[model samples]
Target: MSEDPSLHQSHPDIIKRLKRADGHLKSVIEMIEAGRPCLDIAQQLHAVEKAIGQAKKTLIQDHLDHCLEDVVGPLPSDRRRTIDEFKEITKYL
Candidate 1:
Protein backbone atom coordinates (compact mmCIF):
# COMPACT_ATOMS: atom_id res chain seq x y z
CA MET A 1 0.00 0.00 0.00
CA SER A 2 1.10 3.58 -0.64
CA GLU A 3 0.62 6.60 1.60
CA ASP A 4 -1.39 9.87 1.61
CA PRO A 5 -3.83 10.71 -1.18
CA SER A 6 -4.46 7.07 -2.02
CA LEU A 7 -3.01 3.66 -1.47
CA HIS A 8 -1.78 1.65 -4.42
CA GLN A 9 -2.55 3.89 -7.40
CA SER A 10 -3.46 0.99 -9.68
CA HIS A 11 -5.75 -0.65 -7.12
CA PRO A 12 -8.92 0.59 -8.82
CA ASP A 13 -7.98 -0.82 -12.18
CA ILE A 14 -6.90 -4.08 -10.62
CA ILE A 15 -10.19 -4.34 -8.75
CA LYS A 16 -12.13 -3.78 -11.96
CA ARG A 17 -10.13 -6.41 -13.72
CA LEU A 18 -10.73 -8.88 -10.88
CA LYS A 19 -14.44 -8.16 -10.92
CA ARG A 20 -14.58 -8.91 -14.64
CA ALA A 21 -12.66 -12.09 -14.04
CA ASP A 22 -15.11 -13.05 -11.30
CA GLY A 23 -18.02 -12.63 -13.70
CA HIS A 24 -16.25 -14.62 -16.36
CA LEU A 25 -15.50 -17.35 -13.84
CA LYS A 26 -19.18 -17.57 -12.94
CA SER A 27 -20.04 -17.89 -16.60
CA VAL A 28 -17.51 -20.62 -16.99
CA ILE A 29 -19.16 -22.46 -14.13
CA GLU A 30 -22.51 -22.10 -15.88
CA MET A 31 -21.03 -23.40 -19.11
CA ILE A 32 -19.85 -26.47 -17.27
CA GLU A 33 -23.27 -27.03 -15.77
CA ALA A 34 -24.87 -26.68 -19.21
CA GLY A 35 -22.52 -29.23 -20.72
CA ARG A 36 -20.91 -26.76 -23.08
CA PRO A 37 -18.18 -28.21 -25.26
CA CYS A 38 -14.85 -28.63 -23.53
CA LEU A 39 -12.99 -26.62 -26.17
CA ASP A 40 -15.20 -23.56 -25.75
CA ILE A 41 -15.00 -23.75 -21.97
CA ALA A 42 -11.26 -24.11 -22.20
CA GLN A 43 -11.02 -21.01 -24.36
CA GLN A 44 -13.13 -18.99 -21.96
CA LEU A 45 -11.07 -20.25 -19.06
CA HIS A 46 -7.96 -19.15 -20.86
CA ALA A 47 -9.34 -15.64 -21.21
CA VAL A 48 -10.18 -15.51 -17.53
CA GLU A 49 -6.73 -16.76 -16.67
CA LYS A 50 -5.13 -14.04 -18.76
CA ALA A 51 -7.26 -11.36 -17.16
CA ILE A 52 -6.26 -12.51 -13.67
CA GLY A 53 -2.63 -12.68 -14.68
CA GLN A 54 -2.76 -9.12 -15.97
CA ALA A 55 -4.35 -7.92 -12.77
CA LYS A 56 -1.68 -9.62 -10.70
CA LYS A 57 1.04 -8.07 -12.82
CA THR A 58 -0.50 -4.63 -12.42
CA LEU A 59 -0.71 -5.01 -8.64
CA ILE A 60 2.84 -6.24 -8.20
CA GLN A 61 4.27 -3.59 -10.47
CA ASP A 62 2.28 -0.85 -8.77
CA HIS A 63 3.65 -1.87 -5.35
CA LEU A 64 7.15 -1.90 -6.77
CA ASP A 65 6.66 1.49 -8.43
CA HIS A 66 5.10 3.23 -5.43
CA CYS A 67 5.59 1.58 -2.05
CA LEU A 68 9.16 0.35 -2.38
CA GLU A 69 10.36 3.28 -4.46
CA ASP A 70 9.53 5.64 -1.56
CA VAL A 71 12.91 4.97 0.00
CA VAL A 72 15.76 7.45 0.02
CA GLY A 73 18.83 6.57 -2.00
CA PRO A 74 21.87 4.74 -0.53
CA LEU A 75 19.77 1.93 0.82
CA PRO A 76 21.57 -0.41 3.19
CA SER A 77 22.81 -3.63 1.57
CA ASP A 78 20.24 -5.74 3.46
CA ARG A 79 17.36 -3.53 2.38
CA ARG A 80 18.68 -3.45 -1.15
CA ARG A 81 18.88 -7.23 -1.16
CA THR A 82 15.29 -7.52 0.05
CA ILE A 83 14.05 -5.08 -2.55
CA ASP A 84 15.94 -6.93 -5.23
CA GLU A 85 14.34 -10.17 -4.10
CA PHE A 86 10.92 -8.61 -4.30
CA LYS A 87 11.62 -7.27 -7.76
CA GLU A 88 12.80 -10.67 -8.83
CA ILE A 89 9.60 -12.24 -7.57
CA THR A 90 7.49 -9.72 -9.45
CA LYS A 91 9.04 -10.93 -12.69
CA TYR A 92 6.96 -14.10 -12.29
CA LEU A 93 3.78 -12.08 -12.15
Candidate 2:
Protein backbone atom coordinates (compact mmCIF):
# COMPACT_ATOMS: atom_id res chain seq x y z
CA MET A 1 0.00 0.00 0.00
CA SER A 2 1.10 3.53 -0.68
CA GLU A 3 2.04 5.50 2.38
CA ASP A 4 0.96 9.01 3.26
CA PRO A 5 4.00 11.25 2.86
CA SER A 6 2.57 13.74 5.31
CA LEU A 7 2.87 11.10 8.02
CA HIS A 8 6.63 11.16 7.49
CA GLN A 9 6.99 14.91 7.79
CA SER A 10 8.74 16.05 10.95
CA HIS A 11 7.72 18.93 13.19
CA PRO A 12 10.07 20.39 15.78
CA ASP A 13 7.26 20.94 18.26
CA ILE A 14 6.18 17.35 17.99
CA ILE A 15 9.74 16.19 18.43
CA LYS A 16 10.03 18.31 21.53
CA ARG A 17 6.81 16.94 22.95
CA LEU A 18 7.91 13.38 22.25
CA LYS A 19 11.22 14.01 23.95
CA ARG A 20 9.42 15.39 26.98
CA ALA A 21 7.14 12.38 27.06
CA ASP A 22 10.15 10.11 26.89
CA GLY A 23 11.67 11.89 29.84
CA HIS A 24 8.42 11.59 31.73
CA LEU A 25 8.36 7.87 31.06
CA LYS A 26 11.92 7.55 32.31
CA SER A 27 10.92 9.43 35.43
CA VAL A 28 8.01 7.07 35.92
CA ILE A 29 10.37 4.13 35.74
CA GLU A 30 12.66 5.75 38.29
CA MET A 31 9.70 6.45 40.56
CA ILE A 32 8.68 2.83 40.44
CA GLU A 33 12.21 1.78 41.24
CA ALA A 34 12.25 4.09 44.24
CA GLY A 35 8.90 2.82 45.54
CA ARG A 36 7.03 6.06 44.93
CA PRO A 37 3.33 6.39 45.71
CA CYS A 38 0.95 4.63 43.33
CA LEU A 39 -1.18 7.72 42.79
CA ASP A 40 1.78 9.84 41.76
CA ILE A 41 2.98 7.22 39.29
CA ALA A 42 -0.54 6.98 37.88
CA GLN A 43 -0.60 10.74 37.32
CA GLN A 44 2.60 10.55 35.31
CA LEU A 45 1.16 7.75 33.23
CA HIS A 46 -1.89 9.85 32.54
CA ALA A 47 0.25 12.74 31.43
CA VAL A 48 2.11 10.49 29.02
CA GLU A 49 -1.17 9.28 27.57
CA LYS A 50 -2.40 12.83 27.09
CA ALA A 51 0.82 13.85 25.37
CA ILE A 52 0.62 10.90 22.98
CA GLY A 53 -3.00 11.72 22.22
CA GLN A 54 -2.09 15.30 21.40
CA ALA A 55 0.67 14.15 19.06
CA LYS A 56 -1.66 11.77 17.29
CA LYS A 57 -4.22 14.50 16.80
CA THR A 58 -1.60 16.80 15.32
CA LEU A 59 -0.45 14.11 12.89
CA ILE A 60 -4.02 13.34 11.84
CA GLN A 61 -4.69 17.00 11.17
CA ASP A 62 -1.57 17.23 9.07
CA HIS A 63 -2.59 14.17 7.07
CA LEU A 64 -5.97 15.72 6.34
CA ASP A 65 -4.36 18.96 5.26
CA HIS A 66 -1.88 17.30 2.89
CA CYS A 67 -2.85 13.76 1.89
CA LEU A 68 -6.61 14.22 1.82
CA GLU A 69 -6.49 17.22 -0.54
CA ASP A 70 -6.58 15.09 -3.68
CA VAL A 71 -9.18 12.66 -2.37
CA VAL A 72 -12.20 14.07 -4.18
CA GLY A 73 -11.21 14.16 -7.80
CA PRO A 74 -11.51 11.59 -10.60
CA LEU A 75 -10.30 8.57 -8.61
CA PRO A 76 -12.80 9.14 -5.84
CA SER A 77 -13.34 5.47 -5.13
CA ASP A 78 -9.69 4.74 -4.52
CA ARG A 79 -9.34 7.83 -2.40
CA ARG A 80 -12.41 6.96 -0.36
CA ARG A 81 -11.09 3.48 0.28
CA THR A 82 -7.77 4.86 1.40
CA ILE A 83 -9.49 7.32 3.71
CA ASP A 84 -11.68 4.58 5.15
CA GLU A 85 -8.55 2.57 5.92
CA PHE A 86 -6.94 5.57 7.53
CA LYS A 87 -10.00 6.16 9.70
CA GLU A 88 -10.09 2.53 10.71
CA ILE A 89 -6.45 2.55 11.69
CA THR A 90 -6.85 5.76 13.64
CA LYS A 91 -9.93 4.53 15.49
CA TYR A 92 -7.79 2.78 18.08
CA LEU A 93 -6.09 6.07 18.95
Candidate 3:
Protein backbone atom coordinates (compact mmCIF):
# COMPACT_ATOMS: atom_id res chain seq x y z
CA MET A 1 0.00 0.00 0.00
CA SER A 2 1.14 3.50 -0.82
CA GLU A 3 1.51 5.96 2.04
CA ASP A 4 0.56 9.60 1.87
CA PRO A 5 3.63 11.82 2.05
CA SER A 6 1.57 14.96 2.72
CA LEU A 7 -0.41 13.22 5.42
CA HIS A 8 0.27 16.04 7.83
CA GLN A 9 -1.49 18.50 5.55
CA SER A 10 -4.02 16.52 3.57
CA HIS A 11 -4.99 13.81 5.97
CA PRO A 12 -6.87 16.11 8.33
CA ASP A 13 -8.94 17.60 5.54
CA ILE A 14 -9.64 14.16 4.09
CA ILE A 15 -10.67 12.81 7.46
CA LYS A 16 -12.98 15.75 8.03
CA ARG A 17 -14.69 15.16 4.73
CA LEU A 18 -15.04 11.47 5.45
CA LYS A 19 -16.53 12.23 8.86
CA ARG A 20 -19.10 14.47 7.26
CA ALA A 21 -19.94 11.72 4.84
CA ASP A 22 -20.23 9.24 7.68
CA GLY A 23 -22.71 11.49 9.44
CA HIS A 24 -24.71 11.91 6.27
CA LEU A 25 -24.70 8.15 5.72
CA LYS A 26 -25.99 7.59 9.22
CA SER A 27 -28.75 10.09 8.60
CA VAL A 28 -29.61 8.30 5.38
CA ILE A 29 -29.95 5.04 7.26
CA GLU A 30 -32.23 6.70 9.78
CA MET A 31 -34.27 8.26 7.00
CA ILE A 32 -34.78 4.88 5.41
CA GLU A 33 -35.73 3.26 8.69
CA ALA A 34 -38.13 6.08 9.48
CA GLY A 35 -39.77 5.81 6.05
CA ARG A 36 -38.85 9.30 4.96
CA PRO A 37 -39.76 10.65 1.56
CA CYS A 38 -37.70 9.39 -1.30
CA LEU A 39 -36.61 12.89 -2.32
CA ASP A 40 -35.16 13.73 1.08
CA ILE A 41 -33.38 10.42 1.38
CA ALA A 42 -32.04 10.81 -2.13
CA GLN A 43 -30.71 14.26 -1.35
CA GLN A 44 -28.92 13.08 1.77
CA LEU A 45 -27.51 10.14 -0.12
CA HIS A 46 -26.25 12.47 -2.82
CA ALA A 47 -24.54 14.62 -0.24
CA VAL A 48 -22.82 11.61 1.24
CA GLU A 49 -21.73 10.45 -2.20
CA LYS A 50 -20.37 13.84 -3.14
CA ALA A 51 -18.47 14.16 0.11
CA ILE A 52 -16.80 10.79 -0.37
CA GLY A 53 -16.05 11.49 -4.01
CA GLN A 54 -14.47 14.83 -3.21
CA ALA A 55 -12.33 13.25 -0.52
CA LYS A 56 -11.06 10.63 -2.92
CA LYS A 57 -10.31 13.23 -5.58
CA THR A 58 -8.52 15.44 -3.09
CA LEU A 59 -6.39 12.54 -1.87
CA ILE A 60 -5.35 11.46 -5.37
CA GLN A 61 -4.53 15.00 -6.43
CA ASP A 62 -2.64 15.67 -3.25
CA HIS A 63 -0.58 12.57 -3.81
CA LEU A 64 0.06 13.67 -7.36
CA ASP A 65 1.18 17.12 -6.26
CA HIS A 66 3.11 16.39 -3.04
CA CYS A 67 3.82 12.71 -2.69
CA LEU A 68 4.97 12.33 -6.27
CA GLU A 69 7.44 15.15 -5.85
CA ASP A 70 8.71 13.74 -2.58
CA VAL A 71 9.17 10.26 -4.01
CA VAL A 72 10.44 11.18 -7.43
CA GLY A 73 12.68 14.10 -6.45
CA PRO A 74 14.15 15.94 -9.46
CA LEU A 75 15.51 13.02 -11.43
CA PRO A 76 14.19 12.65 -15.00
CA SER A 77 14.08 8.86 -14.75
CA ASP A 78 12.16 9.06 -11.52
CA ARG A 79 9.79 11.58 -13.08
CA ARG A 80 8.86 9.08 -15.75
CA ARG A 81 8.26 6.48 -13.12
CA THR A 82 6.02 8.85 -11.22
CA ILE A 83 4.07 9.72 -14.36
CA ASP A 84 3.63 6.07 -15.20
CA GLU A 85 2.51 5.25 -11.71
CA PHE A 86 0.10 8.16 -11.73
CA LYS A 87 -1.34 7.05 -15.03
CA GLU A 88 -1.95 3.61 -13.60
CA ILE A 89 -3.63 4.99 -10.52
CA THR A 90 -5.90 7.31 -12.49
CA LYS A 91 -7.35 4.37 -14.36
CA TYR A 92 -9.35 3.47 -11.25
CA LEU A 93 -10.91 6.93 -11.09
Best by lDDT: 1
For each candidate, how many residue pairs have backbone atoms clashing (under 3 Å)?
0, 0, 0
Model 1 lDDT tens row, 1-93: 555645676888999999999999999999999999999999999999999999988887887766667754568898788878878887885
The global Cα lDDT (0 to 1) of model 1 is 0.86
Cα lDDT for residue 48, candidate 2: 91
Candidate 2 stretches greater than 4 Å from native: 1-10, 71-93
lDDT values for all models: 0.86, 0.76, 0.83
Which residue pairs clash within candidate 3?
Answer: none
Candidates ranked, most accurate by lDDT first: 1, 3, 2
Poorest stretch of ten by lDDT in candidate 3:
1-10
All candidates: TM-score: 0.73, 0.66, 0.72
Model 3 residue 22 CA deviation (Å) reads 0.4
Candidate 1 wrong stretches, greater than 4 Å: 1-6, 72-92
Model 2, C-alpha of 48: deviation from truth (Å): 0.6
